[model samples]
Target: MRHTDDKELIRLLRLSDYAAFEELHHRYWLKLHKLAYRKIGDRQDTYDLVQELFIEIWEKRGTLNFGEELPGWLQKRLWFKLSGFFRKRGFNGKHQENFRQYLENQGFDKCFDPAELREVNACYEDLLAAINKTIEEMPNRMREVFILHRRQQHTVDEISDKLNLSPKTVRNQLDRAIARLRRSTEAYDATALEILFIVWLIF
Candidate 1:
């Protein structure tokens, strides 16, 4: 029926009504997907984030809040998720530049067999991208120092000389970067091997 109301649907959804949820998805799938894809800017990332969000909504049906408009609720949740996406990577100006330069320095062009580069490029790009404009919010010297030492594999003295700063300052910046990466990647709570499912993503 064209009479569908989000409030009624949300109520039914909380009661484990598959028909209501399915209908809601059918009605809003395109709109939600498009908004998510724009923020994430990657097809798979968009799909994965949406799937996780909806799945959580399904699992927490009983506690789901929908006193206001459902579309507005979704918008708020999407923005929150986009914010989480940035925090998850510990992204900052220098950290981000370091990552870019590291990729270039490693010659991403040469890292893969030429024939396989396309596939690798697609996957890696999908991983790094998402909505987060605050990447430029880092302090200048902090960003520069973090990038030089951690990303470029520079020694503390090398970074100090390159930036005309003290070695102790470089060391402190490196420590902060290390702290950020630790916090960001810690969300997955797994090592690369585990993520690969070679040992299972969870123990």
Candidate 2:
């Protein structure tokens, strides 16, 4: 598809046209997957993230700001998604005063600089690796419950039915999974919190 076709496709997308969604997905899937891969370094995660990104864009098309370049706009949204992933993973704050002071020292224009971007990516990669490692080491039952609830997007009720466990048991398993993750990454909490703060500053 030509660059000009993006606008027409987006227009159609706003009207919930299936063809438009399919064409846009065809046009950008590879690039979006590559973008997600560069940050995540996991093939499955990259594919899932990209798919989620497109689903979100398609769902919100009526209110989307396509801007001049669709890819540019998409990248910004992907960054936000990545940031949210970290935030949800329990990056504990390092004293409110320290966080505020750190934010005060940073400026907006540098968010896009090569060095700053590298630092941001490094922080993100580190946190992601740590989280994945922790999850990998989870107890079998907890891991299964965590994966079903978080990665597979299954509801607790659904997981309980699938696993033949009580709903409270499923919820308890998920809570334990999160607690274990937080404990596993406590050493990096300060750095991850600072990194997440920078992300909030940027977008």
Highest lDDT against the true fold, candidate = 2
- Which structure among the candidates has the greatest TM-score? 2
- Tens-digit lDDT string for candidate 2 (2-86): 4538778888888998888988888888977765554455687668878888888878888988888887677666766766654
**How many clashes in candidate 2?**
0
List TM-scores for all candidates, in order: 0.43, 0.45
Worst 10 residues of 1 by lDDT: 194-203
Please estimate how well model 2 matches the true structure, expressed as its whole-model Cα lDDT: 0.64
lDDT of 2 at 101: 42
Model 2 scores worst on lDDT over the 10 consecutive residues at 112-121
Cα distance off (Å), candidate 1, residue 42: 0.8
Runs of candidate 2 exceeding 4 Å displacement: 1-4, 90-203
Write down the lDDT of every candidate, Cα atoms only. Answer: 0.53, 0.64
